[model samples]
Target: MLSGVGACPAVSAAEADTTDNAALNDANTTIIVTGLKPDEGQNKISQSGALGAKTLFDTPYSISVIDAEDITRRQANSIGQIFANDPSVFSSAPSGSTNWWGTQIRGLGVRNYYIDDVPLLLYWGGDFPLEPIESVTALKGLTGFMYGFGAPGGVISYRTKRPTAEAMLTTEIGYRTSSVFYARADAGGPLSQDGRLGYRVNIGGEKGNAYNQAGINRLVGSLALEYAISPDLKWYATATYEDSNLQHEPFQFYWANYVGNSLPRPTYDYEKLNVANSYYKARTLAAATGLDWTFARGWSARLTYGYTNKYHRSNKMFVYMRNQAGDYDGYAYNFAELDQNHFGQAMIQGDVMTGPIRHQIVTGASFQQTDSAFGYNDRDYYWGNDFNGNIYQDQPFRVTRAIRFGTGGWPSKEQQRALFLSDTLHLGEHVQAMVGARHTRYRLADLDGNPLVDSGYRTSAVTPTLALIYKPAPYASLYGSYVEAMEPGSRVGGEYANVGEVLKATLSRQYEIGAKYEHRQFSLTLAGFRIERANTIDRLINGARHLTQDGLTLYKGVEAIGSYRFSDRLKLGAGVLHLGPSIRNVSAGNEDLRGNIPAGAAKWQLTGSAEYYVAAIPGLSLHGNLRHSGKAPTSDSNTLYVPAYTTANLGFQFNTLIGGRKVTFTGNVNNLLNAKYWTQTNIGEGINAAMSVRLSL
Candidate 1:
C-alpha cells in the first residue's frame, strides 16, 4: 500500500493548471480520474476525461446533465420530477413517497441513483433529496465500460456538494395544492481557522398528499468533511441518511379494462387503500472515505472505500372483485429486504512525454461486493360480496385460511474486480487522440457457497474506446469517437426447473458514433447510434414468474441537444429524441413478446426551457419549461398504449431586504395545464398540477 507524503512541485503546477482551466472556463471538458482533481473550476470535472464533456457532446450518444441552476429553476420536489422535462427518460412506476419511479433510458431498464462516482443499485423506494447535489449527469447507452456493470441502457451520476472554504447558508420552504409541504436547509464552510479543514451539511424534509389520494413523508440528511494532512496529502469523508414512509393507491389500468378503446374514469377508493394501510417504509445509510496523495513529478494516487446499507418493508393488498354481490378476493403481501454493499477503488495517474508522443495515463483497480436478503409473507382474504365496484366488506373474512406459502429466502452476493488503462495522446498541437481499454472479471455465489449458475456465468470482458478531437481555434472544437461496452447477466438459482445451467445469464453490446459543435455562447450536439444485444433476458409468458432467457434485441436512434446563452440575462436549452425501430426476439413459446416494440420506447420526445433574469426587479428571475412524450405501450403485448402528453412549468424567485437582512422568496407551478397524464400505465398514476413557496436567508 502507498502511504505518507511525497513532494513534486511539477506535479502540483500541472494539476493546478488542469483544475483551474476546468473550474474557470465555461467550455466542456473530458472528465476522467485525473480530471476531477480538487481545485478544478466550479465542479468542472469530466464525466469521462478532462475534456470528456466536449467529447460527450461530439460523440454519437444521447446524454443530459442537470446542473445546480436547473434544479433551482425548476423547484423540483424529487428527482423523478426533474425527468418530467426529459424525453429520453421515463419512469415505470411510482414509489409513492418511499420509492423513486423506476427509470427507463433509451427504452432499456436503468437505475439513476449515484453518489460521488459510485453507483447506488439498491432501490429503497423514495427520491433522493437534491439539497446536497451539485449536478446530475446522464449518459445514454451501454456505459458499463465507464461506470461499471449492469444495464446497457445507460447511467446517471450525482455529484454531491463538497466542503468548501467559504461559509454559506440557504433555507427554503414550499407548499403545493396537493397538501404537500417541503423544507430544506444547507450550510457549509470551513470549520476551522485553516481552510484545510472544512465541513458541509444539508437537511431536507417533506410531507404531502397526491391526486391519487396517496400520502408521503420523507427526511434526508447529509454531511461532508475534509482534512488537509499536508500540502501533498488530503483526506475526505461523507455520509448520507434517508428515511421515507409512503402510502400509495395501486394503479388500475384503464386501457386493459377497455381492451382496445380508452376506458372511463377510474373510481379510485383512497379510503380502502388507507384502511388496508397499503404502504412501504424504507431507510438507507451510506458512508465513504477517501485519501489523495501527490507525488513528485507528474504523478498522483487516490484511494476510496465506501459502504451502503438499505432496508425496506412494504405491505400491499390487491383485490379483484367478481360480480356486484359484495364479494371480493384478494391477497395481502408483506415484503422485507436488506441490502449491504462495499466498494473499494485505487488509482495511479500521471503524464509523460516519450520522445514526440505526449501522453496522459491513468490506471486503476476497483472491487465491489453486494450482499442482499429478501423475504415475502402473504395472506389471502375475501369479502362476503362486492357492491358493484365498491370495496366495502360487511363481514370479517377467515384468517386461518391463509396457508404458509413457501418462502423465497436467500442471500445473494456479487463481486466484481477490474483493471483499466487509459491514455490521451497529443497528436501535434491542433489534434488529440484518446484510447483506452478495461478488463473486468465478475463472480456470483449464493449463501450456501454453491455455484449460482453455469461456468459461463462467471465471465470477463474487454471494452475499448477511441476518440479524436480537432481544435482549430481556442474557443471551439470538433470531435467524434467510437466505443464499445458490455453488460453481464444475473445468475440463476438451482431451484428453477427446466432451465439448464447453460442458460444462466445475459450479455449486451453497443456501437455508437456522433459529432459536436461548441462556441462562446452556444453549444449543439447531434448523434445517431445503433445498439444490439445478444443473450438478452426476457420473461416467458407462461413460465415461472422469475423465469428469464437469453434472447436478442436492437435499438437505433438519433438525438439532438442544444443550449444558447441569448444574453447576460437570458438562456435557452432544449433536447429532442427520435427512435427508429426497437425490436425484441424470443423463443417459440415466447411469441407473445416478438415483433412488438419494447415498453418505454417512445417514437418521439421533446423538451425545451427558457430562463430570464430581470435586473429591473433586482435579483428577480422567471423560468418556463415544456415537455412532450409520444405514445408508448405498456408491454410487448402491444394491446395497450399510453397516449402522448405535454406539460408546462413556471417559476419565479427574488431576493428582498428585510430588517437589514436578505430574504429570498420563490414560487413554482408544476403541470401548469393540470393535464391528466399517465406517466406509467402499469402503475396507474397521473400527473397533476402543484404549487410551492420557498424563503431563504
Candidate 2:
C-alpha cells in the first residue's frame, strides 16, 4: 500500500535547520517506504510566511500537503492535476489552457500563490515544472493575518528541492498519450568535503502531439545552492526557468450575451476537431535568496527576497452561440502581457514565559511590488459575418485570414507593504489561545497616463485573527478560529464603460471550527466554515455595462476527510464536501441575481482513493482514485448549468534493484473509462495515459 502518501504539511526555519540534513540522507536510500516514520510529522502545520510550526492537532486551520513522491506516482504535469481528488478545490480551466492555474477554494477565487514562502504577484497565467519541487502546501480559508494581503480562497506555497548531504543522481524517462515523450535528470551533492556547501540541479524537456492533434512543447531547468557558515547560520539561493507552448488549443464558450436562457449540450467531439491558428506561449524566469539564523536557544530569525519576470502571448478565439440551432460568432484576439514582481520578507520567532503561561511569539514585515504592461502590437479581429459557423462543425484559420486589426498600449502598477505579529499562549497542557494581526497598505496606479484613474487608488487596513484550541488527548484536538483578509479590486476590461478604472480594495472575513484526530493507524479531520465577502460585478446602466462592487457573497460549507491503514498491505482514503454559496442584497438592474449560486461553485463533491501492496512480491503496488462533482452554475445569475460528472484513474508501480542500484517503473491510465466531461462549465477534457521509469545511483 501507499501507506506514507498523504499530506505532510511544513516546518519552520529553525525546525528545518535541525532536521533537513538527516532527513535528506535517509530519504535517498529508498524510492518507496512501507510505513510512516515517527519523525515525519505528516500532519504538522506551518504558514508559508515563516510562522512558527505546530502539529496538525494543535493548529486551527485546514491544510494539505502534496509531496514529490505523490507527483511522480500520479504523473501530474499541472496544478489542476495535482489536486483533482481534493473535494475543496475547483479548477476553472483544463491543463492545456493558458490560464490553467485559476481555481476556486471554498467558493472564493484564489488571487495569489507563493514559492518557498515568498509571495509572487500572479493572476491566472503561470505554471511551474514539477520535476524540481519538493512539496506543495495548501492552507484553506482566509489568510490575511498569517499572510499580508490576499483573497479569501486560501494560500498555496511551493518548496523547491534542495541540496542533499550525500552525493546522488537520478534519471527518468516518460511517455504520454498521442506520442508524447520526455526525459529528466536530477543530481545533488556537497561541493565541500565537510558537507557545508551543497548544490542541486534539475533539467527536463518534452515535445509531442496532444490528444486532439494539438502540439505541446516544454523546457525547464532549476538550480539550488546552500551554504552553512556555522551550526547556527545558513544561506541559500535558487533560480528556475521555464518555457512552454500549447498549439491549437480550444477556447472557452460564452453564451450569456447572445442567448436569453438556453443551455448547450456537451456533445462537441473535442478529440477530432483541430482549430488552427490558436496557440499560447509562456516564458518565466525567477530567482530567490534567503538567510536563516538561530541567534539564541529557542530563538530564530529569517530574511528572504525573490524576483520574477513572466511573459505570455496568445491568439485564441471566443465563441458566442447565437440561437438554438448552435450557430455561433467567433472573435479571435491576439494578446501579450509582461509582468514583473519583487518581494521581500523578514521575520523573527521565539518562545517566552510569563508566570505559568508560555508564549510563542512571531513578528514579521513584508513588501511586494508588481509592474504589468501590455504589448503594443496586440489585436482583436472579427470574422467576416456575425454568424460565422456552427458549434458542431470545424472552423479553420483561413476563415479569418483576411481580417486585420491592432490594439495596445496599457500598463498598471501595484505595491503592498505590511507588518504582522502573532502570539500563541500555551495555557497549561490542554488549552491554547492565539491572537494575530496584520496592518497593510495597498496602492494601484494606472501607468497608462489615462485620466480614467485619476490618482489611482490607495488604502490601508488592519486584518486580525483569533483562535482557541483544546486538546482532549495528545493525538486529538478541537479548535475554533476567525480571520479577516483583503484583496485589491479587479481592473475594468476594455469592453466595460469604466475601462482602465481601478476599484477600491475588497474585504473578506471567515469563521471556522474543526476537530482533528491522528492516532497510530488512522487520521481524520472535520471542519465547518463560513466566509463573507464583497465582489466586483458588472451591471447594465443606461444601456452600457459598468463594473461596480456591491452586496455580499456568502459561502458556508462542511468538510470531512480521513485515511486508514487497515494492514501492512492496504490503505484507504476518502473525503466529502457540501457547499452552500449564494449572492445576496443586490439592487438596481441586478436584483434578479440575488440568492443565486455563484459560477464555478459546486454544491457537492466526493473523492476516494485506495492503494494496495502485493505482499507476495518484493516491491509492487496498485492504486486507484475516484472523484465526483455535482452540477454547478455556469453564471452568477444561475441561468445556465453544467451537469454533474465523475472520473476515475488506475495505476501501478514496481521497484527493483538493477546493477546494485535502485530502479522503479510506473504506469497510469487517467480517465480509465474514457469519460467525456467538462473541466469547467465550458472547457472539455479527453482521456490520456502515462508511463515512466526511474533509475537511482
Candidate 3:
C-alpha cells in the first residue's frame, strides 16, 4: 500500500526538535526548532488541499513551513515580523506600520491568504495575531489549480491550534523594545468525560510605547471547539477576534508627482519621525466551521465554510518630497475601510488501482463572495492641505475629525465560483505524475449608492497545472511543474486620473523544477522557477496619468534551503535566493524602459541560523541568525537603487523545574549591532529587543 504524498522524506527522531510541553516529565528539555522540522508521521505533515495531508517529501510544490516554536523564538507579532529571515520574502513596507504594507513573495505581491485552507477576504496583507496559530505554510508560485482567483505570486496559509486530548494550560509574560508589555494564555483539553468533546482557548493583550515613541496596543481572543460524532467523522468550529491601534503609523511613500531622480536618505531620526496623523485603528473578526469524514478505507471527504470581517479607520498624512533638499508638500487623508467575505468549499479524495498503475484522485468545488466599502464623508474626510513642511522639521500632526461608525457604504463587491479536479498517477515505485485544472467564474460590481446604476465586469477562466515526480532513492525526490492562474484587475488609486476605473483581468503562468532530500541528520531542498504576468503600469494619457495593463513582466529565481545536525548539541540551517526580474514588450514610447529591472526586486538574499544546546547546563540553548540582502532597484527604470545591508540577531532560552512545574525563560536582541537600515524603498526600522517568561501547568 502507498502512503500519502509529501514534499520530502522524514528524518530520524534524534535529529528532530521535540518538546515535552504536552507530555512533560521530570527530565529537562530544550526546544528551539525553526523552519522545517525533522519529524515523522503526522508531525511532518504539510496540509496540501486536494492533494491530501501530505508530508514534504513527494509533494511537487516548493513550500516552507514555520511552526509556533520558531515564531516564538523570533517574537513575531505581525505578518511582516514572521518571515524576517526568509530569503524569498521581501517586506514592501515598514513592519510597525499598517497591515497593508505586505511582503512580496518571489518578487510578486501577495494576493491570497487562507486559514486552515479556507480562503480569506483580505485582498492586501494581513496583520492578524499569531498567538492562536499552530503553524504557517508558504506555497510558492501559481496555485490556480488548488486555489482559484488569486495572484500568481503565492499563497500564505495558517493552521490554527486545535483541542488536545490531554488537558493543558500555559501562561506567559513578555516585554519588547523601548517600553512594551504583554501577557498571553493558552488552554486546551477534553470537555466531556467520554473524550468526544474538546475545546481550546487563547487570549492575549499588549500595550506600550513603541520604538517610534508612539503608543501601540493590541488585543486578541479566540475559541475552538471539536466533537467526534463517530469513529470516522469529526466536526470542529472556531472564532477569533483581534483589535489593534498604532498612534502615528508611518504612511507608505508613493511616488506619484516626484521630480527627483533618486530617493534620499532620511535626514531625521528613524524612530522619532512622526509622519502620519494621531492614530490608526484596525479590527478583525473571523469564524469557521468544518467537518471531516472517512467513509471508506482509502477515501475521505471534507466540507468547510468560513466568514471574515475586517474594519479599518485611518487618519494618515502623505508627504511627497519635491527636491534633494528634503523639502516636501504634505496632505491629509481620512477614510474608514471595510472588507468582508463568505467562503465555502467541499473536497473529496481517494485511491484506486487500474491494472498495474495506482491512482489517487481528488475533486473539489469552492465559492467566495467578498464586499469592500470605503467612506470619505459622514465622519471621514480627505484634503490637499495647504500645509508645507521640510522632512527635517518637526511638523505638528494634522488634527483628525470624529468618526461616526456604521455610516460607510459598500463600493465594491466580488464573487468567485470554482470547480476543480486532479489525479496523481503512481506510474511505478519510483515515478508519479499529476494533472489538474480549475474552472472559475468571477464577477465584480461597483455600487455608486444608486440601486439602478450598478456597473461591473464578468469573466471566466480555466487554469491548469501539470507535474512529474521521480524518486531515484527512498530519501530523495525530483520534480517539475507548470501552473497558470487568473487574477482580477486592480482599481486605480486616488492619485491616478482614472482613480476608480478597473482594468481587464490578467493571466499569469509559472514553470518550476525542484528537488528534495532527507536523511538521518541532514535535509536539503532546491528549486528554480520562472513566472510571467501582464504588467500594470502608469502612463500619461490626455495629460492625465492612468494605470493600465500593458507589456509583460518576468521573474525568475533559484532558491536553496537546508539544515544539518552536526551533533546532538549542534544544528545549522541556511537559505539563499537569487532573482532576475525584468520588463519586456512595452510600447514604442516606453522602449527605453524595456529590459530594465523591476522595482523592489532584490538580486540576492542569504540567511543562516545556528543553534547549540549546552552540555554543561541541563536545559539551556543558544541561537543566532544572520541575513544579507543585496541592492535592489528602487524604480522600474533601474535608474535608482537601495544599498545592500546585513543584520544579525542573537537569542537564548533556558528551562527549569520550579515547585514541580516547568518554567522557561527566553531573551533576544534583533539588530544586535544597532545598525540602522531601510527595510523597503523608504521604510526603515530601529533596533529592538524582547524577553518572556512562561510557566506550564
Candidate 4:
C-alpha cells in the first residue's frame, strides 16, 4: 500500500509518513510482482492503472496484466505478436503500412497509447520494439472518467524496467527467420551506498532480412534513472532513442479497391510478392521525468511530464491494385511526416472518513498535445503489368520515383486538457462503491492558416462512471459498472459541403459486469461488456479514407481469461472472446450499411498456452501455444471475408550455469502448419523460427 503499512487498506499516521517513494516513482511498479521477493500485493489489487493504489477486488473494471516473463516465453517482437495471446484484441495491419500499433480493442481502433501512464499520441506512426518493456496493463471499456479524453476502446500502459536493488548485468543474442540476427544488453545498479539513487540501461541492434524478402536494420536504446531524495519523496527520469529502416517494403493488398470485383483472395510466394528497391526509414527520440511526494498523513501527490518526436519517410512502387483479370496497376508514392507530442499530469490522493464510512479519493489533472505535418508526393508514370516476377521485380528506381506534388495540408495540432475525480467508498467491510467523473476541453488547429468551417474549433465534454463491487470472499469478487468517454472527432474532407471542418467529439458509453477469482498462483476472470458510440461513419473517396460521423456504432462482447497451475511442474493459460459490431442509424443514402458488420472486425478469437518445468532436469522447460481468429469482414458490404485460420507454436527453455553465472537458452518454431491466411486484408507471414541465448552475471 502507499502507506507502507501492512496489507490492510487503512492508513495509519505513522505508517503514512513512510510514504510511497518506491511505489509512486514507477507507473507500473504498483501491482506487478517480480524479482527475488515478489511484491506482497501481487494477488491483492492495487489502483496501479486507475485512479489510485487500491485493491482490485474493491474496484469495478475488467483489467489484464502481461508481465515480462510472459513476454520472454512468447518471443513476441511486435505489438501484433504480443496481443496474439489475448482474444479481446486484434493486432494487424496492411503489410506495407508503417502503422505498427494499429491494433483494435473491443472492435475499436486503439488510436492512442500511453507510456508510464502518459499518453503518446499517434503511436502507430512511430513504432518501438519491445526490447525493454517490463509489463503492460490493459484497462478495457470507457476510461474518460478515470483518465481524460481518449478513444472508448481502452488504454494500454507500457512500463519499462527500472534499476533493481541488486546490481545486475545480462547479454543476449537472438536469431529469427529470413536471416535476421540481433544482440542486446541490460545492466543496472545502485549509484549510491545509501541505496537511494539507481539506474538501468538497455541497448540493442539488428540487421537482416524480414518477411517477404524485406531487408531490415534497426537500433534501440533507453535509460532510466531514479533518486530517492528522502524517505517520503522520490524522482525518476527516462530517455529513449530508436531508428529503423526497411530496404524493401512488404506486400500490401487492397482487396475491394483492387480487382474492383469479388474474387477469392490471392496468394504469392515469399520472394515473389514484395516490392523491390522500395524503402522506409523512421527515427524517434523521447524523454520523461516525474516526482512523487507524501507530505501529510494519509495523503500523497504526484506529477509527471513527457515528450516525444518522430520523423519518417518512405518510397515504394510495388504496392498495387488488380483489375478484373488480376493484372496489376502499380502505384508509386513518397510519404513523409513529422510528429511531436507532449504530456503532463498532476494528482493528489488520500484517505478520508465520513462518520462510519471510509472514503479513498483521488483527484487529478492531465494535459496532452500533438503537432504533426504529413504529405505524399505522387508519381506521373504508371505501370500496367503482371507476372509472378512483377511483384518484387523493379524496372528502375528513376522510372518509379515519385515526383513532388502540389501542396497538401495536414492535421497540424491537437490539444486536450481535463480534470478528473474518483472515490472508493466502503459501504461495509465486504461491499464498496466506486464513482468518478471527468471534464475535458479539446481543440484542433489548422497550421496552413486556412479559415474553413470547423477550422480551429474547440469542444468540451463531461463523462462520469459508477461501479459496485462485492467481495463475498477473500479469493473472489463480483463487480458491475457503467462508464462514458469522449473521443475527439476528425476533420471533414473537401468532398463534403463543410470541407476542412472539424466534427464535435464523439460520445461513447459502456456497461460491464464481471467476476474475478484468484487462489495461490491461479487466477481467472469472466467479463461481459457493451459499448456504443454516437456519430460514427466510414467511407472511401478515391481509394482514400474519408471518415465522417453519421449516427451511431455499437460493439459488444464477452471474454474469459484464466491461468491454472496444475502442479509444480505444469501450468496452462487461455483466453476466448467474441465481438459483434454494427453500423446503426445513418442517412437515407447510406442506410444500406445499417446493421452491417464493420469491416476488419473479427467475430471470434481464442488462444491457449501450456508450459512444463522438468524437476529432475533442474533447468529445462517446455512451452507451446495455439491461436485462432474466426472469419472477419473485409468490406463494408460484409460479403468479402477473410477466412478463419489457426496457428500453433512450440518452444523450450534451458537454464544452467555458465562459469558459475546464470545462462538461459531458448528456441521456438512458429506457424507449425505454415498456414496460408490473411491477417489484414492480404497480409500474412508464413512459417518461421527463432532462438536466443542469454547470460547473466
Computed on alpha carbons, the lDDT of every model, listed in order, comes to 0.58, 0.72, 0.74, 0.67
Question: 405-484, model 1: which lDDT tens digit per residue?
Answer: 22245446778888888787877777778887777787765543345453334777777767776767533345566666
lDDT of 4 by residue, 1-697 (tens): 1111111111111111111112122211112222112232225434443377655555577765565555665676755566666778666653224664457777677765677776665553524556767766667777877777778878776777788777878778998876889998888889999989999898998888755566878899999999999999999998878898877655445554554444434453655555566666778777789999998999999888999877766554443445434445555445566778898888899989999899988998888888876552233212223323243344333334344422344546788888888898988788889888888898886655353634556888889889898888776788899998888876553323445556777788999998877665566778898899875555666666566678677788888877766665676788888887887887886888889877777879998877776656656677788889887776666756677888888888766555555666888877777777766534566678889997776
Residues 1-697 of candidate 2: C-alpha lDDT, one tens digit per residue:
1111232221111112211322232222223333234535334444546345665555687776776777787787766667766778666565555554467777677766888776655563645778788777678888888776777889767778999988888888998877788999888989998999999999998888765456779999999999998999999999888898878766556654656454555553663233675667778877899999999999998888999877776565566666666667766555566778889988999999999999999898888888777643324322223226766676654334532222246667778899999899999999999998889998875657463774557888999989999998776788899989887777766456776676778898999998877666676778899999886676777988788887788999998877776765677788888999998777756788889887778889898988776656646778888888788876687876667888888998776666655667889887787766654424555678899998776
- Point to the candidate with the largest lDDT: 3
Error of 2 at 159 (Å): 1.0
The candidate 1 region of ten consecutive residues with least summed lDDT is 1-10
TM-score, predicted candidate 1 vs. hidden true structure:
0.81
Residue 666 Cα positional deviation in candidate 2, in Å, after optimal superposition: 1.0
Between candidates 1 and 3, name the one with more favorable TM-score: 3
How displaced is residue 643 in candidate 4, in Å? Answer: 0.8
Candidate 3 lDDT, 101-205, residue by residue in tens = 356788787878888776665643365678888887777888788788888878888888889888888899999877889999989889999999999899999
Give all TM-scores, in the order shown: 0.81, 0.91, 0.93, 0.87
Candidate 2: 10-residue stretch with minimal lDDT: 10-19
* Model 3 CA deviation exceeding 4 Å by range: 1-24, 27-43, 123-125, 256-262, 267-272, 275-277, 376-386, 400-410, 449-456
* Residue 168 Cα positional deviation in candidate 2, in Å, after optimal superposition: 1.0
> What are the RMSD figures for all models against the true structure?
8.4, 4.5, 3.6, 6.9
> Candidate 1: which stretches are off by over 4 Å?
1-43, 47-62, 92-101, 124-126, 249-258, 261-276, 317-332, 376-408, 447-457, 474-477, 491-503, 535-546, 584-595, 681-697
